[model samples]
Target: MNTGKVTLLSAGPGDLDLLTIRAAKALAAADVVLLDDLANPGIVSLAPRARVIRVGKRGGCKSTPQAFIQRLMQRYASKGLHVVRVKGGDALLFGRAGEELAALRRAAIPVEIVNGISSGFAAAASLGVSLTHREHCQGVTFITAHLQDHGEPDWAALAATGTTLAIYMGMSRIESICAGLMTTLPASTAAAVVQWAGTADERRLVTTLGRLADEANAAGLGSPAVILVGNAIGEAEAFTVRGFGRAASEGLAHAA
Candidate 1:
């Protein structure tokens, strides 16, 4: 019997237009598609003839177990059915692609990865700021607020690096994260949060490291938002029309 193949695809920050050609092709040819909560529902239309299954994993909500998702992929591939595992943002970045890849390999299954735009980039674009500016930051760091082992990340060391930080799954722990970074980074370091990035409903707030948590809470920002911190962010008044003190309703417009 011929073994089916598996494709790990990135859905790209909740926007259908952000999907890559390769990702779209894979979706169109999939025999079965397993989609995450972050993926846009419109993507399902790409694989009209395939079995589309919702296997989303969201924080503080009922999520599909990782083990079960892996097993389902393995089973489907063994049955000679092409499986597409769709995740939001880049599949390899905080999407748990490692576990699924390892499991498929152990099961002797064929698997391929198709990359897509990450939320960090989208967030940066929405704020009209570059994560890496030669005068400000030399590099960028992508970190998750949710720890797999439930242990705290070394925020002080990360802050010392002086790289721009793009924090994911951080809304719930915003206060602590801001406090931790304050230990090493200055209280005046620029910070911003982009919620629902790359879409029509996107919202953004710019503030200092010391006020990020408070401003985010005041704006009612929650999970599924990307938190950016670094001097590279500068000030909101410089880019957004709403000036520095208030949250902007739309984040993509550039200031002339």
Candidate 2:
């Protein structure tokens, strides 16, 4: 019997056009496709004849068990079928690709990874700001608010790093995260939340670290949003403010 292979493909922030050529090829050739809830539904169309399985795992919602997903992949690949595991954003970043990789390896299956643009980058792009602006931040850090142990993250250490922070799955704990960061980062530190980044329903809120939770709540931003914190955010916020001011001034001038 011929051995099968598995490809972990990143769907690239819910936009099919953002998919890499290699990722598209893998999907087109797949015999089985394991889809995630956050992934763009259009990706499934690429796997015309493949058996598409929805194994969505969303926070605070009923989700497919990780073990079951791993077993399904292993079972399909062992039967000489090309399996494509479609994940939103970059598959390796907080997507549990490590667990699936381990399972496939233990089953003696061939596995390949296709990288895609992470939501962190997408969120930043949507705001027209660079997370690593030379005068603002030297680097960027991507961390998840949700940990497997449900324990707290080292907010103090993270704040002390002075790197731009792109926090995922943090909407539910925005208040706690903000409070924790305040211990190290200044209350005036700039922050922003970009919800549904890269999609048509995108929304954003810009405010100070001290007011991020309240501002986000007032704006009704929730999960599937990226929380950005650091001086880098100031650049975008400033631009937005200037644009708003200019528009208001033009309206008054026209009225006069």
lDDT of 2 at 33: 97
- On the 0 to 100 scale, the lDDT of residue 8 in model 1 is 97
C-alpha lDDT of residue 140 in model 2: 94
Superposed model 1: Cα runs more than 4 Å off = 1-3, 241-256
**Superposition TM-score, candidate 2 onto the true structure:** 0.93
TM-score of each: 0.93, 0.93
Name the runs in model 2 displaced over 4 angstroms: 241-256
Q: Listing every candidate in turn, what is its Cα RMSD in Å to the true structure after a full C-alpha superposition?
A: 3.2, 4.5
Error of 1 at 61 (Å): 1.1
* C-alpha lDDT of all candidate models, in order: 0.87, 0.86
Q: Which 10-residue span in candidate 1 carries the lowest summed lDDT?
A: 247-256
**lDDT for each residue of candidate 2 in 26-135, tens digit (9 for 90 to 100):** 99899999999999888888889799999999998999999999999998988899999999999999989999999888888999999998888987776668899999
Per-model clash counts, in order, read: 0, 0
